[model samples]
Target: MRQMSVRRKRRDRPAEDAAGPQVPDLATKGGRLAILDDTEMARIHEVSVTLLAEFGMSDAPPIVAELVCAAGGRMTEEQRLTFPPDLVARALAGLRRDVALCGRLPEHDMALGDGAVHVGSGGAAPMILNIDSDTYRETTLGDLYDAARLVDALPHVQFFARSVVARDMDTDSLLDINTCYAALAGTTKHVFVSAAFPEHVADIAKMCHIVAGGREAFAARPFLSLNINHVAPPMRFSPDAAEVLVAAARAGLPCMVNTFGQMGASSPVTVAGCLAQSNAETLAGMIVAWLANPDVHAVYGARPMVTDLRSGGMAGGSGEQALLTAAATQLARFLGLPNSTIAGATDSKIPDAQAGYEKALSITMAAHAGANLITQTAGMQAGLMGASMEAYVIDNDMLGAIRRSLAPVEISLDTLCATMIAKTIRSDGHFLGHPQTFDRMKSDFLYPGLADRRSIADWQASGARDIRVQAKELATEILAGHFPQTLAPAVDATLRETFDIRLPVARMTKP
Candidate 1:
């Protein structure tokens, strides 16, 4: 027994499927939405516990420098490091602050900390997906198996991040165990592997031991999680990748730290020295998840992007990724953790006008700076290292206009109508649909696809082909008509013979 628990059958809500594409929760405005306070979240947990007791991590990985010298931590020089902010506030007081993501048929699962805006894609970067055709810059593996079958058939992609980087005749652990068995044989969601070490977290712990059956039945049922990457400061993290993130946080699953500090290089150039070395490399990977399991689950991730050096590349604009996404989402929701930070990435590779004014100020200050889990929403470009199907259909219209301007306002007093404005000021014409304009028009109408509210002879006889040719014909009609969420023919023949999946037989041209 003792198997279930994928955080007890994941779901915060919305998976119903009367034919997909519903997604629009953004953590309820008509309900609550608006956190981060406690004196600015205890001043972002006392500046990430004074940057891990005065500057700790860097280059670590001799089994995470032998568990930062068996937890007492102190090395400096030779894979440089240091720790003990009481072992990162005892890994933020025994972690696990909510971690959902399940749906092998529980109504198609989809939900990540409710406050909506999940969309993910791109990690490990080889990007440049067949943009403008003729294999423009060739990044293949059939473009990460058609971007993991169009991000498991996008319902605004809730999770996915082994985003695309395939070039290994085996770069140490058979390329994330054959790119996580070809992105779980083309997406059923949940992916972010990047486990580049700890023997690729034992090949993502042996593809969760051939899908939940070993290593304590895949650690009481954790499908796959290891987006690890905390090597900031000319490179940190290597005590053998913090002892394989303390062996996948003592097998409870979760190591998504991802620290990116490059304002002037190795963090702290400004933007509060790169959100204080990405909040001390995500609380020193939550102090190796409180020395590998105080109750594991430490994501507090980051992306930090920007190394422009006057156009050397990597400045997905919007005033430098909207001030590094409102100071790393106000220092990761003032250290309450679990907010990987985002805002429709755009180094502008076609969806021009600096890709719609740098993707509407980093996806509207990453939804009013109260992030939970939002990565480079849809295909990126040039500075973020290009990936445009027309910037993923103008980032699904920049995530339906920053989720309808973070919704919220629905006050009463009959919403200030004052008796329909005193009988429409004696009928001098007023409201457009009056039930308060049909209750604020679907929370402020946001209908866009290829922008440009036409006029010039109705956009030159309609179909004046722009918005990057209708986002490259909607990425060739979603890579030839979509179809996500698959894998079930006896779990696709035990994941195509535990990852051997043929396709290399091009030898007999003897015809």
Candidate 2:
């Protein structure tokens, strides 16, 4: 048995110096909810191990099968590669827990597997709600860049995962290269992108290396990671995606092996059954990556989606979806792996009241359940088929509130406030004018930037604009003004000369 030391570093917050009380670090305030007890979690793990040991996964890539076989996995008569319980256990134990998803800037970096939660944009939606026209259209490479910029500007959205697919690209290689380029150009924060083919992974890595100044620097703090869907659900490995996983592991890139199994369709109808199968599949991915390179940073992405039996479509906003995602987070934690799950993907077509409640319920539940990374927390809509810019702006405010909800109650003498209460009673008879009240205002409270909190009369006087309209205005303002200079001029020139970068430079800068 190989001994692996767990790296459990918490997310670093801005230091509090002479500068007034620092804003509380919301990422550190999760893991407060556990839907499954120890016995239930153990039972789920048992089922998953049994599934891998008996049922096994089919269609494993040649390299994956070879590596697994070398690591004690067996090829059955049915041509499925089965992992023994002991091999699965060893793989789980060998996984490096402290995986840092580094950003271009140090402050934007996120430390995973340390019991903290981070929410960011997700989905490779084919369509986007045009900010200028308020209509859904096929997403282009420019839309992907603009969406990344929106996420970069939004304070609450911590990372950028290529939200919309660039549908205008003619070829798979072009799509893969441009998608990665646009994301890197738009945000200095950590980025996640998918590779269409195994060969494209090297080109994307080369692009990242140029952005990071060299190969060694990029490897030390990789600003980009791959979100590989290695499994096709129903106990089968996607050949191309599995090959991409192998390539990513060898390249030393952080990879999130996402296994999205839709219940009642690709997986069993029951939640527990879906979880067990998804867990088995996710473990299989990790085992492959581990065998490829045990030092590779791999995040367990067990995203089990919900299916509405009546409509036979995805129910991304359903309460059942929230429960399943939260339960998956628990399962990941039980195995002590850095994990991510999908939430806030409302089935609503727009960012209306329905979108609000659906996104809030699912996102909040996942956060409380302590998912290390919660994707699709911003900009996803129409059951993850569309990305909305205005929705991203509105979801920022909602995520801020959710993060604040996770903040621990400070019970210090100052917070206890017996002295202040007595002083207020003896003096102004209210704490409204108190110094503590004024001092804690900025530090303790997180005021929404876009949410209208004014009086009804004031709102009416100001034209009584709804949240969607306000969000559109704000998003438009951000898109117009906030063009981040993530890449240096020299690096940009070199990249353009090297790869088929589609996003125009004029669009990345303000005119």
Best by lDDT: 2
lDDT tens per residue, model 2, 1-511: 1111111111221123333443445655578788899899899889999999998999988999999999898999999999999999898889899899999998789999856899999999999887777689998999999899888888789899989999999999999999999999888889999997799999999999888989999989989999999999899999999999999999989999999899999999998899999999999999999999999999999999999999899999999999999999988998999999999989998899999999999999999888999999999999999999999989988998898998888788878988878878888898877777777775787666567666787678778789888788778777887877888899999999999887888888898
Error of 2 at 476 (Å): 1.0
lDDT of 1 at 313: 54
Listed in order, each prediction's TM-score against the native is 0.34, 0.94
> What's every prediction's RMSD, in angstroms?
20.7, 6.6
lDDT of each: 0.60, 0.88
Model 1 C-alpha lDDT per residue in residues 1-511, reported as the tens digit of each score: 0111111111221222222233344442211333344575466557656766666666676666676678787876644567767766666666766665443334334344434345566645565656566244645555666676665554445566666666633454666666776666566666667665565575567666666556676555455677766554533664555667778777666677766666765565566556666677767776666666776766777767677777555676658667677667666654556666656667656567776777777766766665666676776665556565556556666666666677776678887768889999788677875665754454445444445565676666664657666567656666665534355557657766776543231210111
lDDT for residue 130 in candidate 2, whole number 0-100:
77
Clashes of 2: 0
TM-score winner:
2
Residue 430 in model 2: shift from native, Å? 2.1
| Each candidate's clash count | 23, 0
